[model samples]
Target: MSYELQAVIGAEAVLRKVAAQQPGAVVVPLRQGFALIPMTDELFDSATDGGRGDGLRFSKLPGGFERVLADWSTAGPLGYVEAGYAGGVGTQRAALWADGDLAIGPMFVDVNEPFPAIGSPISQVLAHLGATRRRRDPDEFVAVGLDRCRDTEAWLAVDRSVLPEVARSRR
Candidate 1:
């Protein structure tokens, strides 16, 4: 089944703090982690227009970024740690920052574009493919130029930078 992630409870205060610090960003929760989506005119205008197919639940992409937190949520394991959206007709991309130490993703686009031609990595992380362990650097975080995790079109954009800070900030 295809699943979408949602926000978490009790994370509102921290999300608000992060939002205040981030200015144009809105905090969203993935089953695996959290996302920091930017508040742009294009984002607000494009989400509810049925650009994606039917049953595409955009409950996470609220019309307003500053709306009050609600208490309803789906009970399940989080699929992504965070996510980023690229709003457009041809490339309505959803870059999902998935959770777990070994997860690699964030580059889920509406259209399939060639890799290594669209993005740059935030940092590098250790990856395990079956029994092999190696370091996919710089571009690991960026999906376009990423070498590993090529099959899923997912990159490790958020592995190094955000996860640590999120952990520290929680405590």
Candidate 2:
């Protein structure tokens, strides 16, 4: 099915870096806008192996601001959240964020099936998170976090951080 998810950043939380790491933080642009770094390796592995915690839809590599930004820009705002799974056999879970706020479900979908259109539940989720079909610059928007939902209740929280270069670049 190969489902894809997208979200829009908020206005309050312009992407910024956390002082805890070097290079401060990095923002990777996508076709629609910029994105925070991909889920951590531990998180990705855990999700893929079906160990602990929710699973992720995408995986990211280590790199610098320019490279990530360039990749995101070219790749468009949309990227793989998770792949290599089907019918609960392989990895099928993915997490997407708008800023620091979780967007939708650990959106479970068959990577082998066609993605849902904008009016479907998945599409609505992406829309609620701010995703748009029109192209946008990451610097023009803010970032939000992603959350897992079942029925109407949210049960999980995914933290997101922005890149420091965003500020310098903006200046």
Candidate 3:
């Protein structure tokens, strides 16, 4: 099946700060201490200067968004990752923010191409965020259980009972 995902992945603590700032943001816990906030149309419209579209230009994402991620780095690194696949071919982009700065990358990877020695863009961010690969796991994506869902919308189906809080304060 084809896969697609676009979201911000970070430690639950760090994402809580994001949720606080972007009302209606949901913090869906993953394996380990990490969690993800599915980037919705509303969030994109509110955060970007370029208006919503297919690509993410961090410069267009506004200084306020970066300021929140910067301020919460003590909790952990945060990354925005987008991936899309069809018929086994896909593209992925990822950027890591830690210690109030861009740490790893806003790197892009062609999933059907030979991956960099380090791994795919998302795996690099996941590795930086402390995800470890298990014997049967192909990469951090699967190791963190991201492979369980083909898209962010499906991932958002996570049981709310596990989340410490889900921001529903926005319209």
Candidate 4:
């Protein structure tokens, strides 16, 4: 099964707010950063159905901007997970992921305005998925070149260094 994760960046003001709120979380400047979401085909399909498809959610940490980073999986058909903002409201964004050691996927430009928030519902979803909150150091995020997904077989190219860059550029 194949799954796609998206990191959306909206207005610069919103991006700045996100950075300020979660200084330690990954933050890339508008038109300069990306968001990495990982999932399987089954999970992705379920999310489209308004169900708890994958049992994972990306959440922002309390007292700062670090998102509770982790993975979530479930055994039920109705169980699912959510990542990113709720009701969408800010920043220009991009999505990235890896295939073994290669990065391949879509790099959307001029994303939708008023993107979702990284807090609230996303946090609740993460907890439901049993994800453990781990502080992702700002230096840990990196940057990489992303290509558009041509077909289902395409994989997003990513490097370990890219993770930290995603957070650093926001500052």
Candidate 5:
């Protein structure tokens, strides 16, 4: 099976567990498995969605693949739309900026393959926890290895914890 399909399946199981942990959240099915967003806003409009890019409703999936971050078997890059689709996916994967800004996906472009940990936006965050060195830090200063953070192919699940409660609030 395609890695994307595997991602979807994997996402389904994980998000379902997340739903149990996160009150008000439920697993909403997509073409493949499912994504987790609040259950009440299942029919939300894509145009006005602010949580992610245009939001993360499965209902907003483009009929045909528009120019998106990456191409994969059946499953696609599922992340905040504006950030993932705007111009470039930027250095950050899902960062929230002060100017009402948010970055989008490092979509599960390939689940079977390991992510490029050296210069990815996620690598930048790892630097902040004081748990590791910046990717740019001298090779000798590489505080901690990225094996724990990197080495995953799937785009991360929609982690609402990163955003404020208002961001997750229904529109």
Candidate 6:
């Protein structure tokens, strides 16, 4: 029942543009006009040669991510959002870029530690992207259907056969 994700959020057309430009990229539609490009392990590996961090890396983003996002900002704003949860403990992180500038956070929320405000980091970013909160939903994250799957890889429906075998905690 736990979930995890790392993705770039933007308008569907904008995300499609980025997906077309970047090999192996795919857009997962969300509520509203916004969609997300899930940063799957394969994509991450190809971008960073097995996800190496020795050369260069952004604090929250992977290496060279900002440059790619900046180059693709012509269409619209882009936001990077990541989240993970298991055993009732989790964390979420989010950041936004628009017009080639940082618009909002690189914000982080600790869900089970000291706890955070009602609106989580991912929800806040979605709100900034124009995702409205419905009356019944607890937050924008669930409203966007992000809770539909456990991870970005699932969102993309990635072919597990092509991925390297690794033990994942599904408990």
> What is the descending TM-score order?
3, 6, 2, 1, 5, 4
- Give me the runs in candidate 2 sitting further than 4 Å from their true place: 1-25, 40-51, 54-80, 84-92, 95-103, 119-126, 135-171
lDDT of 6 at 119: 77
Between candidates 1 and 4, the one scoring higher on lDDT is 1
RMSD of 5: 14.7
Stretches of candidate 1 off by over 4 Å are 1-16, 19-59, 66-108, 120-134, 137-171
State the lDDT of candidate 5 residue by residue for 101-169, as single tens digits.
223332332213443555343333223222334356542113332121121222233342443322332
lDDT of 3: 0.73
TM-scores for every candidate against the unseen true structure:
0.23, 0.34, 0.80, 0.22, 0.22, 0.80
Local error of candidate 6 at 110, Å? 3.0
In model 5, residue pairs whose N, Cα or C atoms come closer than 3 Å (at least 3 residues apart or on different chains), thus clashing, are 53-80, 53-81, 108-155
Backbone-clash count (model 2): 32
Candidate 6 lDDT by residue in tens digits, 103-169? 7877777766643575777888888887776787788877766776787778777442332211121
Show where candidate 4 strays beyond 4 Å.
1-88, 91-119, 134-155, 159-171
Candidate with maximal lDDT: 3
lDDT of 3 by residue, 6-98 (tens): 888987777977688775578877776678888765665666555432344432243355555556665677987888889989888888888
Candidate 6: Cα lDDT at 128: 83
Q: What is the lDDT, from 0 to 100, of the residue 104 in candidate 6?
A: 82
Cα error, residue 153 of model 1, in Å, equals 21
lDDT of 1 by residue, 1-171 (tens): 221222211223344453453334454321212333333334444433433222223334444221212111121111212223334222222212222221343333443443344342122211211111125334323321222222221222335344443455345
Q: How many clashes (backbone N, Cα, C below 3 Å) per candidate? A: 15, 32, 0, 47, 3, 0
- How many Å off is the CA of 18 in candidate 5? 1.1
- What lDDT tens digits, residue by residue, belong to model 4 across residues 1-171? 222234322233433443343222233331133332333343234234444313222321111111111111111101112223224432222222222211211122232543234423223222232323335421111112222332212323344344454456546
Model 5 residue runs over 4 Å out of place are 1-10, 39-171
lDDT of each: 0.29, 0.33, 0.73, 0.27, 0.28, 0.70
